[model samples]
Structure formats: C-alpha cells, structure tokens
Target: MNSAEKIIDRFGGQSALAGLIGKRQSTVGYWAKKGTVPVSWHGKLLEIAKNQAIDLQPVDFIPIDDEKNLLPAESSLPKATHWGELTIGEKEIPCYVLNTGDRVFSLKGVVVGLMGTDGGQLVEYLKVRALQPHLPSDLLPAENGEIPALFKFDTGGEGFTKYAVGIKIERFNELLRAYSSALLDHHLSAHDSTKIALTDRQLQIATTAVRFLQASSDVGLVALVDEATGYQYERAEDALRIKLKLYLEEDMRKWEKTFPDPLWNEFGRLTNWKGSVHHRPKYWGKLVMELIYGYLDADVAKWLKENAPKPIRGQSYHQWLSGQYGLKKLTEHIWMVIGMASACQTMPELRQRMAERYGRTQVQMTLYLPVQH
Candidate 1:
C-alpha cells in the first residue's frame, strides 16, 4: 500500500478520518487522491491518531521512493479542475472532472462507499463476480480475469504535488450496476445452499444501489455531481430559468379537467366536507398548493407561484401550466397525492404518509391568497 492508503487505514478508513478532522469525507478523499495530507491538517491528524491509538508517524505522509518510481512524472497526470461528492444515503463518494473534461471518482471512495468493504477487495470481488454466469457479460472484469485499469490524476496545490487513483465515472457506474445485480441475485436466491450468506454490509449496498439506480440515470448522475460542486451554476447562469420554462407555459392553455374526480373525492372524504366535491371548499386550494405543487422542484414551484396566473373567476392554476412537460408533471404529482390519500384513513395519517413519501417542502405556501379579480 502507498502512504495515502496507509494513512487512511491507520485513521480507521476515510469516513472516520474525515469525522476526526472535522472535514467532509470528500475532503479526506481529496487528500487520499493527492497521495498526501495537507501540511495544515498534519497536526490535527497526528493528534487524532494518537487519541485513537493509531501508529501514525509524520514520515508516513510522504510518498515512498518505490511508489514514486512506479508513477509517471507529475506532468503526465491530468489535473482535477472540478470535484464534488456523490451522496448516496450516508455514503459520499468523491468525484471529479479533470481539466481534460474526463470525469472520475476517487477509487477508494467508490469501493468503500458502495460496498462498505475494503478498497483492496474491489479487484478480487470483480474478478469473482465477473465469472458468475448470472452476471452480465459486459461487467468490468475481462474473461481473462483482468479488471479495468485505474486512472491516475494530479490534485496538487501551489508549489507541491500529489497523485491519487481514480476510476472513470462511466466505469464506476458500471461497477455499481454489476455489484447491484450480483447482490440482488443473491437476495432473491435466499434458499440456495451454494450461495454465500449475505452480510449486513452487502444488504446496505443493495439498498443504496436500488435507490441510486431508481433516481439517477447516467446523465442525471453527471448533473448531480455538477450541482453538488456548484459547477452547474458556473456552466449556466440561467439554468433554473431554462428549467422553469420546461415546466411552465408562456401563455395559459385552454382549461381542461386536469385533476381527476377521485382526488377531490378522497380529499373530501378525508376532510369530511359536507359540500359537493365539484365545488370544493376554498381550503382545497391551499391543500393543492401544499400537497400537489409542493412536490415539485422547490425553485420551479416558487416560480410557478409567483409567475403563473392566479386562479381567476373561471380558470384554475392548473390551466396555466404548460401543455407538454408542465401538465405531464402536474398529472403525475396529482396521482401521487391521490395514491397517498387512498391509502390513508385519516387526515393525520395522510399527512404522515406525505411526509414519509415526499418530506416537507422548504418553501412555505400562504394558506390564503386573494383570488385575482
């Protein structure tokens, strides 16, 4: 192992080191990538090491001569220009965009984050899992038992140099899919005697994989990384405006029955409204704002509230939504609300379900807004 790996291990892994030093796990990952901790952090790290009963020496931070010889001169390695954490549940995998525009994840971070296992075990896991007939043929390991090559990158600061291992973001995602598939297969075949028993760590990995795969596509993952690092704002100043345009129309469309009858029926049932569902109580408007629109992207929902036409004598807020993407999103959100309403027996129960499913929106909605004259 290199100095960086040794230091990380002695400190009880990347996450533990990060917690000890009062820094983000991604920052510790950054140090690991650079193959050395910053001088400023050295004192704190040593102090933490001593308290933790770790045998960390100051010289351990320096790269060994043999390791240096193995690496190409510093000039050959690409420099990271942008970097951020890809948070999946409690785990955060440090990711970076090179000056060359190539995106990659910290090699050790990816292994530790997804597998909750040792970074050194990744290659061997891939080799074993790749040979499984149940796994995809396109998995990371080759038929000859070779794994994908690790990328080296420079993450040095002024007047100093450091290097760390990385895997291309695409390869990282591929590994996630492979591991997810393997774990899921194991989960499904619980009765098989030949299969190794699933550990708690593997179960956690499986849960994380399902959540990540459900929410993020390859493009979405890139966008998430950009958002986390503030690179998206740098890339496009009007990104929110552009996104709002997709979810709101410049002009109101012809009024239609955008909301289904069952939605109001359920609302009426829950609220115990004696009046007809067709002529919903004025309070229903507030519920719509809270339950339906609240589920949207917070900024998009805010833009709609401020800019979209208010409910006039004849038209409602849904009528002002764009016919294409905006209406599609509205319809989807309505069904989700209706689904929750259908499942709950009481108002508090429905609210609890909503909180569990969507959480509370950060933007507060006014309960009563004057209808436009």
Candidate 2:
C-alpha cells in the first residue's frame, strides 16, 4: 500500500482519521486518492499517531508514485543533495538542489517569503479561476478537477522532510511571471470582477513579483540560484569558457562608432581636459579599458586585452565583441559609466563613484591623464 493508504489504515480507516483530524471524510479520501497527504495536516496527524501508539515515521509521509499506481518499494525516489537559502532584501527562502540537478525552493518558503501567507493559501489561490489562465499548463488542475501533483523530494533528514515539498527554479520564475501578469491585469481592469482578485497578502506577493521581475532576467535568476546554493563553485570548469564564448567573437566585426560622443564629452568635462573633445587624448583609451571594459569579468577583460586585434586608428576594442550578447552588455555598461561621469563634478568624484559602483580600489589619477608634453 502507498503511504497515504497506510496512514489511513493505521488510523482505523478514512472516517476515523477524518474524525481525529476534524476534516471531512472526503478530504481523507482525497489524500488516499492522491497517494500523499497535504503537508499542512502532517503535524496534527503525527501528534495523533503518537498519542495512539501507531507506528508513524516522518518518512512514512513521503509521496508514492501515483503515476504508476504503485508504491516506491522497488525503486527509490530522488533526494536533495544540497541545501541553502536565497535571500532577497530582508526576506529569505530555503532552497535546495536535487541529486538530479533540479534546483527548487520549498513551497512554504515561496508563499511565506513572497506572499506573507500560509503555503496552503497559495495552493487555494492557484485553484481559483482568475489565476488558472496565468499558471503554467503543468501546474493547472487536471481536467478531472484534481489538484496538480507537487514535486516532492526526500530531504535526507527527518528535520528537513517538512521542507521536502518544493517547486523547481523554472517553475518559480513562471509563478512570479504569473503573479506579475495577474497584477497588471487587475490594475488595468480595476472595475472588472473577472480579473485577478488581490487580497492584502496576495497584493504583497504581486508586489514582490514585480520587484523580482524588474531586477532579474532568466540568466540573472540562474546565477542567483547558483550563488545561493553554492552550486557555482561546483560547476564544471568549462562554465567560464562557455560563457566567454558567448560574450566574445571569434573574429572582429566591421568597425563601427560603438562609443557615443556624449561619453567622451562627459569624460572631458569631468577630467578638466582643455583639449577639444572631438580629438580626445590617447589616455581616453586607457580610461575606457579601466572603467568600461574593467567592469566585465576579470578573465573576460584579460581575454579581450590579450587576444583582441590591437585597435588600428579609428577601430576600438568594442569591435572585437560579438554583436549579440557582448555588445548589448557593453552598451549597458557604457551608459552606466556615462551616468556616473555626468553625476560627478570632478575627476576624483568620478573615480570615487566608479570605485563604489564597480568595487575597484582607488587608482592614481595620473593613470588616465594625458602626457604632459
């Protein structure tokens, strides 16, 4: 028998278990039908099991293979191999890495961290009509009206079993996207009841979703997960090599005026250069190397410096960057540098700003000064 069925039988059948737990008999039946118990009821059941002298272990609550209509007696389920917490602002969520390489956050952590509500409430919210459209297809209720199956893991310790229920990292992003979309729809259709219904806690969740979406892209989220779980250190050494391949071109592109004139104009103003901004001093290249390119991964900067074709006259280092990902990142970095330069009144102020933003040690001002000829 599956875990849920065994538990029900131990409590002297579904009706007796329902009476002991103050839940409807159908609810107990549903648990048996799903081959797993809702985690919210675990504590009450465990306590009752203790009082009744029934043999109940935390591992008894691990979900069975409902897909095959069989117990996991012959084959073991996957377990968590790593654990960590992801902190965003003041809130922290417990995260895990399965032996299968899936990254997940506990369902309780997601709801409490993002929504400030009980995890069960989020499950209920997902069942509502307003959220169904925004939810991923896999997360939607079955056509027979059964709740979607949770992706449970064996957390490898009794204390950790309470946190075994989790959603994958990709699903977490999708959940955030859904919350964001629903919130947008609610705001746009304030008068329409058919749109998303936002309770105070759900509004909080939607706000968190908006902030998360604003701050991170798919790639940024992956890196955040890696950093949180310390998986970045365990990653294959070729990870950097693969990333560099994406950011650097194998061959130089046709030279274009990548750096805008405003960047140079602001640089001249901040540095107190008396020379014409149109004919920038050669030291401008050194400044670009330090402030702009220096913001990239140290190895990326080194690779660019050592391998890129030496700038021939009007050509520049940026021409060596791949047009797709590299140029996009470079453009964003350049604009941020220009913004910093525009904010500062003098060269030292600019240097301080760059140092603060990029975590660079203060450098000698003369390093960027023109030759005093």
Candidate 3:
C-alpha cells in the first residue's frame, strides 16, 4: 500500500488520527494539505504522536537514516532564550537624560508592593529595552559622557498606573543630598535649622522615594527623569497634563542656616545653599514611588549613614542635639525625593510612590523619636 493507504490502515484512518492528535479531522486534513507541521516544532509533534500510542503510519514517518548513527541537524535560527523581543511603541523615544552627577536606584519595593509584579518582569524589561543602546552614540562621550545610573519601569496595579524611564547618578554624595531633602520634605517638619512648611504630598514623596546610586569614577549630579506624564510639565501649548516642581533656595538656606546646624557646611551647601533651585517638579508619581520603595532603599540609606553625622547625637551644644538629628531626617527625606524624581515621571505614579516610599520609614522616626522637654 502507498503512504495514503498506510495511513488508512494505521489508526483506522482520518477520523481515528484526529482523536490521536487531539484535533478535528478537518484540522488533520488541513495539516496534510499544508504539507508540514505548524513551524519548526515538527519533531515535537511526531514525538507527541508516538507518545499517544497511535500506530505509526508511513505518511507520518520522517526519514532520518541511521546510516552513520548521526543526530538530527541543529537549527540556525536564534533560539528563544530571553522572554522574547522588547517592543516599545515606534513613536515612543526610549532615551532619557541625566546630569553630571546623579545616582541610580532600585524600584523593587514599590514595583513589587504596588504593582503586584516581582523584579522578574522588571528584569526582563531591562534586559531588552534598557540594555539596548537608546542614547545616541554621539551624545554618549568617550570618558565622562555616559551617565552612571540605572533605569526601570512599572505597570501599576492595586490602583496604580504604568510607566517607564531611565536615571543616572554621579556619586553617593548626590544621592545623600537628594535623599535627605526628600526625607525632610516628607515629615512635614519646619523645625530644621531652616524653617519652612512642606505640603503633605511633598513630604511623602521626599521621604519614601527609592533611587539607585551608581558608584564609579565619574563625577557630576545628573538624573534623567522620564515617565508617561505627557508634556504638561514643559508648559507645552497642547500638553494634556501639567507637572510643576518648586525650587526654593531661600527656603533651603533659611533652614540650613538655622541655629544649631547639625549638617556639615557641604551638606548645607548641597541641600540649602545651592545657587540653583530645583525645589519641586511634577512627574508621573506611580513610577516614581515604585523606583524609590521598590528599588534604591538600601544604597541610599547606607550612603546617608556614612556621610551623615556620626556617634548619633544627644541634646546640646556641649553634646549631640535635636537639630543635628533633625538634619539627618531632613537628609533622608530629600534623598527620597531625588529617588522619586528618577522613578516618578508622571502624576499617577506619584501618589503611592510618594506615600509608600515615605510611609515605610517615616513611621519609625515619627513614632520612636524622643520628645524634647
């Protein structure tokens, strides 16, 4: 009998073969007509058929001659190793920017906490898009051009939004300043050497924000903050959203110069005395929170303790004091903000990104602090 006849005899023909393949007779006929298995997995299909205990048919047979006891030929096409291709919208530009000195951070806490997705998804995302060269080759310099930092994205969950971005940090010092400022902003305290009132949201964002502090030989503070916040913050004519950042040198200096300053002069310079103002800038909040609480918590704190006052502090000019400790709190809060800036590029990401990032550690300080008599 010919191959057709062999098929007919094997599994009692087309109808029986359909049951063996777990497909309709029509599908079997269609595959036969198509003259091949769906794609390159033809070997798997045949193995499955044999496993099902279906009587082998001549037509289903693959001619692998045992002449030299050789194995099947290997494939040339790239194997599907990673989680497939990373496709951002064609129109969407994946490139983000950072200044001279900026820090990179993690979004693990906020991303996993709020988004309900672990670092796996984020890792996959980074493997594809972020790992690729998004920045223009000419733009990246030979020596000090490429910014040192990390990038990430968060597709929000538990009532949150989705967004992505890249960030770069110059050194640990920059990270500390930003984190400290963020912490100060979050506590809603004006008792620093400098006196100022921060809005509730500002305080939250400043305190809890997570960030990455890229450690390297490079110097300069540059953070590339991006998100899906549209162009509202740019004051665009047709912007769909609006982002506002307030920079207050006067406020920073006033607080920094307050009596019994616990912060070093450089700390004061970094936080309060800077000539420029970056007081506040609106961003996609959801993404920001994720990056902060999710990503950079450990590094930021580690750097803070190292650079912040030592021997803790007690209470007077003769010894350690409240203002000094307050300075530490303020530093953490600001650092949180800097982290938030990297993570948060949109408003929705801001809400919880700020809350959780700040909320996590804020309770410890506020609740446990010794009251001044």
Candidate 4:
C-alpha cells in the first residue's frame, strides 16, 4: 500500500483515520495529498512504528523528492493561532474551549463577526462549554437568563480555519411540529382549543404553510452564511445577502418554465381561465410565502399597494408574494427590516420565547435580531 494508504489502514481504515491524526489531521492530509512526508517526520514515523504495531521502512513510502508531481499549492497559514475574547455584539461573553483548536461562543443575531485571538482560546472555550448539557457543542454563551450558555466548534480545512455556532430557532421548530401534527391529524386545531370555523381552519392551514416555506428559505440563508464566512456569522450574513440575490434570479427561470402566462385579473387573483372543468389552477400559498420570506415586508406591501399596477391593488397577500419579487428584492427588504424586531438574543431565550409566545397555539411571530452591538 502507498504510505498514505498504509497510515490510513493502521487506524482501521478511513472510518478511524481522523482520530489517528489527532489535532494535526489536516497536516497529514496535506502530506498524503502531496504523496510525501516532510523530511523532518521520517524518523518520528519510524519511532511510532513500534507503538502502532506497523512496519516502517523508508522505501515503503515514496521519498519526499519529486517536485514536478507535487499536489496543488496549499496555504501553510498556521491554523488560527489565537482566539480573541468571546464578543457577542458589544458584550464579552463567557466561553469554553473544547479541544486544541475548537471554541464556542453564544449569539442569537443573524449578524455576527468572527474574531481571532493570538492563542487557541476559542477551542479551549468550546471544551469548557461542552461539559454542560445546556450549551451546544457549536454554540457560544449569549443571554444568561433565558439561554444557559451553549457550545459550538468550527471544522477547519480548505486553507481557512472555520467556526460555527447554532442559533436555536424554537419558534420555527414549533411551527414545523405543528405542521407535521396537523398533517397527521388532518385538521387545524390550536392547542388552546379555540373552535376554528371551517373557513378559519383553511386560512390557518394556508398561513402556516406560508410561514414554513419562509423558514425553509431561512435555512438556506444560514447555510449560505456557513459557506461564506467560515465560522463567522457576521460575514455569512453578508455573503447570504448576495447568495440570496442569485437564488432569486435563478428562480425566475424556473417560474418562466412552470407558468408561461400566469394571468392575474384586476383584483390580483388568477382569473384567466374558465370554470373548474376548464380551469387554470394557481399555487397561491407557495407564491405568497416566497414573497414575504424573500422580500415583501409590511412596508414593502404598503408601497406595492400605493405604486403597483392599479389592477393589483386588491390582490391578497399570497398573490402579492408569488409575483415578481425574487431574491434581489428580498435581500433589499431583509437588510432594511431585520433590525426592527427585538426578540431572543440567544438559544435559551429562543426556547423560552417559543413557550411564552406560541405554547398554546400552533403559530407565533419570530424575530431574528443580531447580538446587541
């Protein structure tokens, strides 16, 4: 077997390869990719041979000699050497280190910044927080009263050190639970036992569906942050805004394919087809949620009412959401509106808010605010 494959097999193959390399796994990975070990580690490999119960011979693996066939250049930027103090907005948060290069911080805002320190304090902080059940392995401490500190860690690779912290979305979770439960029961019943009239139930179902759709969009936004900022929520949001815009433009292509001439009458309701027997069915809820989640806030809705084509003035919320508003418009609106709401600032606060705001019903308002600056 090749040297990298041999080292890989020594730890029971690929499944356990990561554990064998310890904190320096990426370094070994780099060497393996290049098909050579640094000249300095050759003797150490031989010494480790006895303890690892593996044969070690210089000839067994290719010598570090060839330059022409070396792997693509990679940064030797030392793994983040320092983790600055845990700062959520303006506050210096209490944090714990989890390993040699993992740390946890607490935050609940959609906007956050990742700062580096001179030593490995971030990872040390994560280790400390991991000892407690309330803290997430990927969360840092935020609000003390509602959120009891959390844990989180960054998975570093691709030439950049990474960090991540999970912000609990209990309101969205409850919405999902309510949705799943309603679907299973085949009825829309609030926990408080309010007798929802038949028409009200239908409206509730549609509204909840739209909210969930928005939540799905929110998930995409978070993922965008993860990719762009690499353990920093602050940069992630900036990148997310850009990514969302691209997603909208792409979605427009899909819309053109799906509905070539989705006609709306003067009232903003689909009225271009005949009766049910010769009907052109419209997807109202899906379209509305996409708009509200993507761009149409209260003010935007008001502006549309004032300036939209006169025929569209009376259209419903769902009708408006599904129209031309895509990622670009939504990003613009989110940047403007996200700061208005004040809600939970940490995970525990999120859970608490969920119970207080939505415990008796299947729906509630959720605000995403950044850590206080």
Candidate 4 residue 134 Cα shift, in angstroms, is 25
Tens-digit lDDT track for model 2 on 1-373?
6668978998999999999988899999988997777655665787899999987764566544344433243236567777655544333466778889988876666766666543344566676665568988877767665435455666654432332567887887888888888787768667876676766656776777777655446336656777999988966544443343333243443222457778899988988889998788888888887787667765455655664442445544454342333344556778888988888898778878888876667655655667898
| lDDT assessment of candidate 3 | 0.32
Runs in model 2 with CA error above 4 Å? Answer: 1-75, 118-121, 142-146, 158-163, 191-197, 218-373
What does candidate 1's lDDT look like per residue over 250-330, in tens digits?
Answer: 343322245678889999999999999988898888787778766666555665566544244454545434333334555
Query: Each model's TM-score, in the order given?
Result: 0.43, 0.41, 0.16, 0.20
lDDT of 4 by residue, 1-373 (tens): 3446555565565445455545356776665675545433444565566678776543333222233332232242122232322222222322334344443332321111222221122333323311223234233334442323222333222322333332234422333343344343334334435333224433344344344445447647667666687654434334433333332221132221222122222112322234441243455334333323323433334333343232335545345444443333553443332232123244334334434543333356899999997
Candidate 2 worst ten-residue window by lDDT: 247-256
- Cα RMSD, each candidate: 16.4, 18.3, 26.8, 26.3
User: Which candidate number maximizes TM-score?
Assistant: 1
Reference-based TM-score, model 3: 0.16
How much is the lDDT of residue 292 in candidate 3? 33
Ranking by TM-score: 1, 2, 4, 3
